[model samples]
Target chain A: MGIKINVERTSAPKEKPEISQLGFGKFFTDHMFIMDYDSGEGWHHPRIVPYQQILMDPAAKVFHYGQTVFEGMKAYKTPDGRILMFRPYKNLQRLNRSNTRLSIPSLDEGLVMEALKQLIKVDEDWIPSELGTSLYIRPFVIATQATLGVSPSEKYHFMIILSPVGSYYEEGINPVSIYVESEYVRAVTGGVGNAKTGGNYAAGLKAQQEATEKGYSQVLWLDGVHRKYIEEVGSMNVFFKIGNKVVTPALNGSILEGVTRDSVIRVLRHWNIEVEEKTISIDELVAAYRSGTLEEAFGTGTAAVISPIGELNWQGDKLSLNGGRTGPLASKVYDFLTGVQRGTVEDPFGWIEKV
Target chain B: MGIKINVERTSAPKEKPEISQLGFGKFFTDHMFIMDYDSGEGWHHPRIVPYQQILMDPAAKVFHYGQTVFEGMKAYKTPDGRILMFRPYKNLQRLNRSNTRLSIPSLDEGLVMEALKQLIKVDEDWIPSELGTSLYIRPFVIATQATLGVSPSEKYHFMIILSPVGSYYEEGINPVSIYVESEYVRAVTGGVGNAKTGGNYAAGLKAQQEATEKGYSQVLWLDGVHRKYIEEVGSMNVFFKIGNKVVTPALNGSILEGVTRDSVIRVLRHWNIEVEEKTISIDELVAAYRSGTLEEAFGTGTAAVISPIGELNWQGDKLSLNGGRTGPLASKVYDFLTGVQRGTVEDPFGWIEKV
Candidate 1:
C-alpha cells in the first residue's frame, strides 16, 4: 500500500545555528515526519508537519511505562553536493526488530523509507557541509495510549526529526579512556538488550555517570550473568585487536546488533583481515594486555564511527593500549568508514544510498 | 522552604463517571499536582492545575532514554467519609529511592507530601464510595529535557494524577492463574529491578504478553541468572505458604522493596506467624507442592492489595494451590489490609495517614 504523506511547511522558521557550533541533537530542522498508530487502524496519517511541541495526555504509557523505541542514522552532504545516507535500511530493519521486542506495532519498511527520503528532500538544506558534520536523523516511536497500565500500549506515534550536528571529535580522532564497570549490568541474555529501546540506555546511565566521575569517557559493561565477559562499551559495540585477529563480542542475546559494527566487520573482511566474533572475557583481555598481545581497542557506533580506547581501568588496574594513542587499525577503520560515508572512497560494498 | 502552590481550577468540570462503573484508571479527577525541576533551580513552581494534556518537545529524554520513575497509591474514602492514605510516606521514600537509582535528582519528600495532601483534598469528591473502590493516585517524574542523549536528563516534570478506580477484582477477591516464565527474564541482580522506574516495567511487557496469551493472569518471573529462583510475579511481590510458614524471596539487589510486601511482613509478624524472607527456588516450591506442603500462594501490590495464586504453570507441570481457590490466609490478609486502609480496623502500626 502506498502512503501519501501530507506536507505542511513552517510559516516562521527559526534562525539556523552556526554549522561550526552545532552540537549533537540540540537543534532540529523546520519540519518533521510523523505518523499515528491505533489498535485497529495500524499506522496512518503519514505527514510532514512543522516541528513543534507534542501534546500528550499525562497518563501516556511512554511517561510511566517507557514503551518506546528509537533509531539513529545520518544524512551526509558530499563534497560534490550530493546527499548520502549510510545503510539507512539497516537502521529501519533494526527499528522493527526493536518494535517486535517492545511489543509495538511494526511499520512497513518500504513506506517508512519513502517517507524518510521525502522528509530529507524537503529539509535538504539542514545537512551540514563541514568536514565531519552531517544532518543527524532521529526516528523514534512512543506509546501514546492514555492509560496507567504496565502493558503494551494500544496507540503509538512514530516521528522522525533531523538535527545538524558537528564533528564528534572536535580536535581529532583521539582515543578515549574507558572504565570497566563491575557492579552495574546493562543487559541480560533474555532481556531487551538486543533491542534499540530506551530501557537499555536508561539502565546504563548510572554506570556511565560513575565512569565519567572516574575520569573515563565511557563505561565498558560486562555480561549480566557472570559479570566476566565483555559486553559493550557505553552505547556502542566494542572490538579488540589481540595479537593479529580483530575480535568482537559475538551477537549474544544481550548485545545490540549495531549497524556500524556490522559495516566494520564487512569492511574488515573485504580487506581480507582476520575478524572473529567471539566471547572475550575481561580476564583474557587482562592477560593479553599483560603479555603485550592486546594491540588496540575501539568502539563502533553512529555518533563516532570508530572511537579508539586509549586507557582501560579495570578494578583499579589501568592498561594503556598502543601508547595511549589511536592505533593504526582504529585509524584505518575510521578513515575508511568516514571516507565511504562522505563519498571520498569508492562504494565497493554498495552501502551508501543517495537521497 | 515553603512552597506556595498556584491553584488553577477547571472552569468546565467534567461529569464524574458512575461509581459502580468506574474501572481501574479509566476516569480522571478534576485537578492534578505538578512541579518542575531545573538543573540549578531545583524543584520549583509547585502548583495544582486542571487535569489536561501536557506539552513537551519531541526530543525529551523520557521519550528517548526512558528517564522516568513513578509511584502508585490510592486515597480510600472511609465509611465515615474520611479520606485515608496508607503509608504515603513510604511511597514517597520509594520514589526518591527510584530517583537515586535512575540518576534523577531527589525530590523533597516533605514538600511533595504537602502537595499530595492538598491535591487529594481538592479532589476528594472523586473518591468512589462503593466497596473496594477508591481514588487511585499516580505520582510520576519524567525527564523533560529536549535533548537526544542516553544520560540523565537535567530537567524533569513531577506530576500527580488521580483516577477513581474500581476494585481490581470486581466480583470479589479471586484467585488468579500464573505462568512461570522461563524464557524472558524481568530483571537481573545489579540491574534496575529494584527501582520503581519505567524501564523495568517496559522490559517485562513481552513476557507479560506471552503469559497472558498462555491463559495466565500474570507471569512469575524467575532470577535472570539461574532462571531458577523466584523473583516477582507480574508487578507484585510473591509469597508462598509451605507447611505452616510464610516465605518470600529476600531483598536481593534485583527485587523491588515493595511497600505492600513490607506491610504484609509486618502484619504477619504481628500475628505471630512464622515468616522468613529467603531464597526460594522453583525446585523447592515444586517439591513442596508434591509433598502437600505448598498450602497457599499470593501476590502483594498496591493495586490489588493481595492476589491469591490459585494455579501455577511451571513448564509442563501445574500446581494447584488451595484447590484453585482463595486461600484462608490470603482472604484474611486482604480483609485486614483493606480494613486498615479504609479506616475500618484499628491502626496499630500507624500506617494510615489522613488527608
Candidate 2:
C-alpha cells in the first residue's frame, strides 16, 4: 500500500469496561479508523484517531436517503497473547460489494486492510481474553453530501469502530425458538437483499419485534416473490439436516452470501458430510419434521457463528427440533469455528490472519 | 397545547441567494425546528435553533440500521402576501403513518403544526415570492441511539428544515421521457414501500441513475412480485388517461399514498371526469398505447407536482404520447392544482392552510 495514514493517539484514554459487563456494541475502544471520500479526489487522508462523535450536516444524505453499507467481523486474543482475525480480507471484499449496490464509491481493500491492522494494533490492549469475548469490528460507509436530491452522494465517510463484546445473544450457546414469518417480506430477488445494507435490517425489525412479542427468539424470512422458499433466519444464513443430509438455501439473488455459511459448508465437506444448497420451503421442512427427518437447524453469521435453532413455529405449528437441545453437529461446528478464531485449533483452510 | 417551545434567533444571518439561483433544495433558510425524543420522557425540548450541523455518534442507529422516516411539504408565498401550505395537516398525518411503519414513536401532529407555523414566521423572509418559487419544508425523524443493534433505537430526533426553492426541474412544466425499468425493483407489497421512508428512495437510486445515463429523465417502476403492474414513476404516483377514463394504480399495500395523487383524482372527478383507481399493468398501458387510446400520462408529487410523461420506452419500443407534448388533461390538472396552491383559484376542496 502506497498510502500514508496519519495516526493520532488519544491523550486521555478511558478505563476499559469489565469483561463480564461488556455486552454487544456498547463499549468502544480508544482508537478508530476514518477516511473521507470526495467525488473527484477519491478516498484520502486516512487516519487513526481517538474515538469521538461525528459532526455532520443536518441535511446529510445518509440521514434522509439511508444510503449506507456495513460489515461485521471479530478479533480474538489467544491465551498466549496472540491476536487473530478470521478472514478479514473477505469482509473487505463484501463491504465493497455492498458499497457498489448502495452506489457509494468502492474503497481500496488493500489500503483499508493496512488501516485496520494499524487501528487494531493501537487498540490491542482493549481486546479481552475471556472465553467468549472478542473485539467486534464494524466497518461502514455513509453518504455525507448535504443535498436533498435522491441521486448518489458526492461525499462519504468510511469509518471502522471497535467494540469489546461478549456473545451476541443473551441465550449464549443455547438453542432458541424461531417463528416462520408469512406476512412480511424482507427483500426481493431484484432488490438490495443480497447486499449488507441498512435498509434490509430496518425492514426486518418489525417482523423481529412482532415475533419477539410472541415469545420467539427470531423470525425466519421467506422469499419476497413466492413467499414459500426459505431465505434467511433473522439476518443469518440458515441450514437444516433432514434424513442424514445437510441443506441450506442456495445463493439466490435475494439472500446474503454469508461468510460463515461458506466456512461451515467447507468444514462439513472436509469431515465427509455432504452439504446441499438449494431451494428449501417451509412445507418441505414441515413434512420432514413429520417423517422424523428434521434433525437439527442452525443459523450462521459473524456475530453468532452458529446459533442452534431448537424450535421453529411455522403458522402456529410448533415443531421442536433436536428435542429442544443443541444438536451434536451444531456443537461440533461451533467449537471448530470458535477454536479456529481463538487460535486453539489448527487452521485447516487458512482462514485466520495474524494481527 | 400545553407544551412550551423555546426560540433562539441567529445573530448573523447569511446573505440570501438570488431567487433565480435558488434551485431545488440547494439553499436553506436561517432557522429550523428541532425536537428530541427519549424512551422515558417521550418527545420534548422543542426549540427553534439556527440552522447548523448535527453532532452524532458514529454508531448512531440511523447510520447503520436506516431506522428513519421523512415527509416533504412546501409553503407558498401567495400573490396577496399570505403564506399558504397545501394540506400540511395531511402531510403530518402521513408522517406519523410512516413513523408507525418504521417502528418509531408516534408524534403529536397538532403540536408539530404549531412549531411549523412558528418556524415559518421566523424565516418568512427566505420564502421566495418569484414566479414558481416557494419555501420547501422537509420534516424528518432519525434514530439517534448510539448503538449498533438491529432493533429500533431508544432515541430519536425530529426536525424541520426549510429550503427556499425554485421549480423542481430546469425543464419547468415540459414533458419528460421515462424509461420503463424491468430489472431493479423499488419495493414489494409486504415491505416498507407504502411508508415514506429513506430505504425506498435508496433502493431506487441505481435505477434512476441508469435511466438518466440512457437519456431518460426518470424511470417507471413496476411492482416487485409481478414486475408488470405499474407501481410508480420516479417516486411519484402516476396516472394515465385512456379511452375517456383516467386510471391510476390503487393503493395495493405497495405503492405510496401520495397527497398530490389524491388531489389529482379528486379534481378529475369533481370536474365530471371519470377516474379509476385500480391495478394497471404495463401490458394494459402498452395495449392502450397501440390502439391510440393512451391520451395522457403524468406523475403527481410535491416536488414536480405534475410531470407529464411525454414518451415511454418499454424494452426499446418507444411509445410517444400526445405527440411528445403535454396533453390537455395533464395541462388542465396541473393548472388547477397550482392555481389553488397559489390562491389563484377557488379553494373548492379547502386543501390549503394559511400560515
Candidate 3:
C-alpha cells in the first residue's frame, strides 16, 4: 500500500465547462488515475496523468471477450469546500468482488483508495456546486492482453475518470413510468449478473431501448428463472411500499448488491420503518395495487439516489401509484440521503468519507 | 454494398513465425481491414491498412458497457495455391445479429465480405500449408464513443484481423475431458446467448478455469432454468451419437447457431445419417451412457471443427465415452470436414469460397 505514485499534470489545462449545463458523464476533468497489471509484476506503476486516449491492440480481450469490470461513485462539494464520498470503501470492495467473478487480477484496495483520493484532490475544482450536482467517479478495469483466445487476460489497465454531472432532476423530484420487462432476461442465478461487470449492463441495453420507445423511462426486470418475481428496475435496485411495510428484492445471486440499496434499508431501519428484503412477485404487487394498498415504488442508485416509480406498464395492464406523483416517503428519503451525501445533514452512520 | 475500399500497404512487414510453432490466434498478418460507423452517417471509410494497435479513449463504451460483437472464421491454402474460406457469409450475418441485440448500428454485410476478400488476398502469403492448419480470421466491432452512459454508442470501429495458426491439434484429435457444470450459467433463453458477443464468453471464464484446474479441458453448460438440459460445451455446439441416432441440442433462444455446427449436420445428413435436433437433457445422456448406447460425443466450432468428448465428469460421477477414445463417428466427421476445408476432399455442399 506504500507504492509511490508519479504525478504528471497536463501542460495545457482546458477551461472548465459550465457546471449547470454539464450533464452526466459528458465532461471530464483535467487528470485521471492510471495503473497497470501484469501477471508476475502484479499491479504496478500507479500514476496520475492527463486525461487522454488509450492505445490498445485491436485484439485486446476486453474488446472481443468483455473481460472488464467497473464501479460508479459520486463526490460532492459542500459550501465549506469539503469533498465527501459516500461509502467509497464499499465500492472498492465490490470492485474486487467483480474482479474475482470476471477472473481479473485484484487491486490492492488500500492503494487504490489512496490513489482515488489524491486524484480527486488534484481536480477538486471540477466538482459541481449545484444542489444535486456532483463529480461522478468511474473506476473501471479492462483486459489489455492482445490475444484472440477465450481466456482471462494476463495484462490489464485500472483507470479512474471523473465527470461533472448536473442535478439528476433539475426541476424537482419526479416519479418515472416503468415498464415491466417480460421478454429479455438480464441475468440468472448462475450468471455474472451480481458482479459489477460490463456484460450485465450490456444485457439490459436492448430492454431499456424498447421500454424508452414505449414512453417508459425504464424497464423493471423480473427474475430470469421465473418471469414474475421482481429483480431490478433499469440498472438500479427497486423497492415497493405496500400498505405500511416497505419491501425490496433480496440479494439473489442474479441481483446486484447495490450500495445505495443497503444504505436505503439501513436508513429505513434506523427510523424504525419496516423494510423487508423478500421475493415479491409481480402478481402480488398487482394484487396489492388492485386493493389500493400499493402506496409507492422507487429505485435507488448513485445517479438518482431515489427515483420514484409513478406508473407501471406491465404486459397489457397499467398501474398508477400515489396518483402518479412523488410519494411522501420517497421525497423524504431523497432529501435526507442527498442532504447527507452533500454534507448538509447529519451523518450518524459514518457513511461519509472526507478527502 | 458497392463501397470502394482503399488499400494501404505496410512499409515494414513483420517476420512470419514458424508455421509449426504457431499456436491458435497468434502471429497476425501484415494488413488488416478497418471500417467506421456513426449513428447518422452509417458505416463508412472501409480500408485495408497495416495491422497495428488501435487508439481508443479510456472511457470508450466498449470498455465500460461491453457493447461489442465479434466473429471467427478460418482460411486455408490448398495444394493448388488457392485460398479458400469456409462459410464467411454466415459469420457476417451472425455479426449483424449480435449487433442488433447489443443495440449497435448494423453493418453492410456485402461491403464487409468484399473488404474481407480483398484483405485476405493482400495477406494470402501468411496462410500456413500444414495439415489441419489455417489462418484464423477475427472480425470484431467495438463501440468507440467516449461516453459513460448505459445506452449504445454512437460511434464504432469494425475491424478484421488475421492470425496465422498451427493445427488445432498438432498431434491428433484426442478426445478431451469435460465437466458438466451445475453452478455457472452461460446464457438464458431471453438473453444475448445466441449472439457472438464478448459478454457471453466472459461469463464462461470462471467455470472454464475451475474445470481446467480440476484436470478437465472444458465444462458443459446446462439450461439456466432447469439446469439439466445440455446447452453448449466450451463455447461450441455439442452433439451426442446415441445408438443409431446422432442428436444435437436444438437451436433454442439460448444456444448459438454455429456455422460449423450447421455444416456438420448437413454433411451427416448428406451421408444418409439420421441427425436429430432435440432438447436432450444431461439425465437422459447419463441414462443412455448407463445402458451403453452413448456411442459418441463431440463439439463443433470454428477452432476445432470437431472436438471429441472422451470423458464427462458430472456431479462426482464419471462417464467415459467410447472407452476414453475418439469414436468412429466423431473421427469420420473430423476427417470429412477438415478435408473439405483443406481442399483434399469433395466440396459437395459448396461450403468453401475461393479468396
Candidate 4:
C-alpha cells in the first residue's frame, strides 16, 4: 500500500525551552504525524500537521471502553551529530502485538517506519544536543468511533508526537528506592500484560501514588495470582544479580517485553556473563539478601536505561543493597548502555537505526 | 464548594429520530454537563453546555494511559410524563469509587447529583416516551494532562452526555448464548477489577470479539488467576439458578459492584428467595447442568436490565438452559424491574428518583 504523505508546516513556531532545565515530556516539537483508519478504508491520509489539539466526538470509544495501545522509544543525538533510534523495528513489532490484543487494526510496518523517519527528519532540530537528553517519541492508536457501546471500534486514529526530554534522573546513574507492592497488581497472565497498552498503565496509577506517598520512587509489582513471584516494575523490567548470575522475571505473558531488557541481555551474553530469564519470587530475593549473595539490582527501560535499586521495602521490612549505593555491575551496565545509545561504543548488536 | 451553573442552548436543533428505530447510544440530546479539576483547585466550573466535540491535546494522558472512568444509567419517562432516574445516587457513588481506584480526585456527590438533575431537566424532551425506551445518561471523567509519562495525571475533565436509546433487545426479552472464556482473563483479585473503569473493558474486547465470531452474544469471563471461577459477563454480572437457590459471583476484589446486580439481589430477598453470593466455578455449573438442576441463568446490567442465558458453551461442550427459552424466574424478575422503573409497579426499594 502506498502512503501519500502530506505536509502542512506551522507558521508560528513556539520558542524552545532551555536545554539545561528541560524535564521529561514537558515540551513538544512543531510537527506530528497522524493517520486515520476507517473500518473498510484501512489506514489512509498520512500527513504531518502542526502540533495542536485533536477534536473528537464526546462518545468516542477511547473515552468509554479504553480501546487504545501505545509504544515509547527515543531519538538520540550522537556525539558525531547523527540522529539514531535504538531498535525501532522492535518497537513496531511490539506495537502490532498490542494492536492484536486490543482488537485494533494492524498498521503496515514499512509505511509506519517510513512515516517515523519522515516525522523525525521534519522535527530533527527538536532533538536535544545535551549529554543525557534525547527526543522521546510516543506512537499511540486510539479508537475514535463515536458510539456508546462496549465493543471494538470501527474507526481509529494513529498519531506520533515528539517530546524533547531531559535525563530521567537529575543526578546521573544514582540508586533509587523501590517499594514492593503487596496489594495492587500491574498485570496477570492471560490478560493484556505483555501488550504495550494504556489500560495496563492506567491500572497501576493508584499503587504508584501510594508508593510515592511512602517516599519510594517506584513500585516493584509481584504476580497477580500468587503475589509472591516478582513481576516487572511498573515502568521497566527488573533485574537482580545473585551470586554470579543475573536473573530477570521471564516473559510470563504478563511482563512487558522491554526493548532495553532485550538489549541488556544481549550485551551481558556478549560479555560472557550468565543471564537467566526465569521466575524470581520476592521470597527468593529476600533470601538472597539474607545470604549476602544479592550483589546488585536494577531496572531497564528506554527512559532511564538502567536505574539502580538501592533499597527495597517489602511489608515494612527494609533491605539495603550494596550499602545503599550503586553497585559495580549496575554502574557498568549503565555506562555500557548509555555509551551504545550515544554512539560512543562499537555497534556489535546492530541496534542503532540512523535517521 | 459553590458550583456555579451555566447553560448554553443549541441554535441548530437536531432532527429527532423515530422512537421505534432509536437504537442504543446513537442519538444525543441537546446539552451536556462539564467540569474541570486541577491538582490544587478542586473540581470547579460545573456547567451545562451545548452538545459538541471535545478538543484535547494529542499528548493528553487519557489518550496514552487510558486514564478514564465512566458510569451508565437511564432516565425513564412515566405515563404521567414525569422523568425518573433509578438509583442515580448509586451510580454517582460507584463513579467515586472508580475515581479513587484510578487516582483521580473524588467528586462531590451532592454537587454531582444536582448537576445530573439540572442536565436532565434541561433535556427533558429527549427522554423517549415509548415503552421499553428511555434516555441513556453517560457520566465520565478523563485525565487531560499533556504529558508522556506513565503516571497519574494531575488535571482532569468530567463530563456527562445523554443519548436517547431504545430497548437493548429489539425483538423483546429473549434468551442469548454465552461463551465461557478459559483462555483470556478479565480481572484478578489484586487488580483494578472492582472499579468501573475503561481498562477492564478494554482488556475484554478481544475475548468478546472471538465469542461474537463463535455465535455467542457475550463472553463469560473467568477469574484471571484460577481461570475457573466465574467472574462476570464483561458488560454485566452473571447469575445462575442451581436447584432452589440463586447464585452470583461474590464481591471479590475483581468483580464489579454492579447497581443492577445489587437491586436484583434485594428484590429477590424481599420476595423471600434464597440468594447466595459466592464463587460458582464453571465446573460446578456444568455439574449442576448435568444433574438437571441448572434451572436458569441470566446477566444483569443497566442496559438490558436482565438478559436471560439460553445456552452456554464451555470449551467444546454446549449446554442448553431452559430449552433455549427464557425461564420463569428470569421473566418474573425482568417484568418486576421494568415495572418498577416505568412507575407501573410500586417500588418497595425506593430506587426511583424523580427529576
Candidate 2 lDDT by residue in tens digits, A77-102: 99999999999998999999988888
lDDT of 2 by residue, B1-355 (tens): 6668899999989799998888788888899999999999999999999999889999999999999999999898888899999999889999999998888999999899999999999999998887688889999999999877678899999999999988787788899999999999999988999999888888888888889999998999999998999999998999999989999999998889999999999999999999999999999999999999999999999988999999999999999999999999999999899888888889999899999
For model 2 the local lDDT of residue A209 reads 89
Q: Residue A140 lDDT in model 4?
A: 92
Task: Give residue A43's error in model 1 in angstroms.
Answer: 0.8
Worst 10 residues of 2 chain A by lDDT: A19-28
Give the range of the ten consecutive residues with the poorest summed lDDT in model 4 chain A. A165-174
lDDT of 4 by residue, A75-101 (tens): 999877899888999999999999999
Give the lDDT of residue A338 in candidate 2. Answer: 97
Give me the runs in candidate 3 sitting further than 4 Å from their true place: A168-172, B169-172
The docking category that best describes candidate 2 is: high
* Candidate 4 DockQ vs. native: 0.85
What is the TM-score (0 to 1) of candidate 2? 0.99
Task: Score residue B96 of candidate 1 by CA lDDT.
Answer: 96
lDDT of every predicted structure (CA atoms): 0.92, 0.92, 0.91, 0.91
DockQ, all candidates in order:
0.82, 0.83, 0.84, 0.85
Residue-level lDDT for B312 in candidate 4: 95
Residue lDDT tens for model 1, B152-244: 899999999999998665434689999998999889988899999888899999988988888888899899998899999999999999998
Give the Å error, residue B135, model 1.
1.1
- Per residue, candidate 4 scores C-alpha lDDT tens digits across B1-355 of 4666888888877888998778888789889999999988889889999999999999999998999999999999999988989999999999999999999999998988888999999999888878788899999999999987778898999999999998675445789889999999998987889998889999999999999899888989999887899989858998899988999999999999999999999999999999999988899999999999999999999998999999999898999999999999999999999889989899998899998
Residue B231 CA error for candidate 4 (Å)? 0.9
- Candidate 3 lDDT over residue span A1-355, tens digit each: 5668999999988799986668678789999999999999999999999999988988899999999999999999999999999999999999999999999988999998899999999998889888878999999999999887688999999999999987454333688999999999999999998999989888999999999899888899998898889999999999999989999999999999999999999999999999999999999999999999999999999877899999999897989899999999999999899999999999999999998
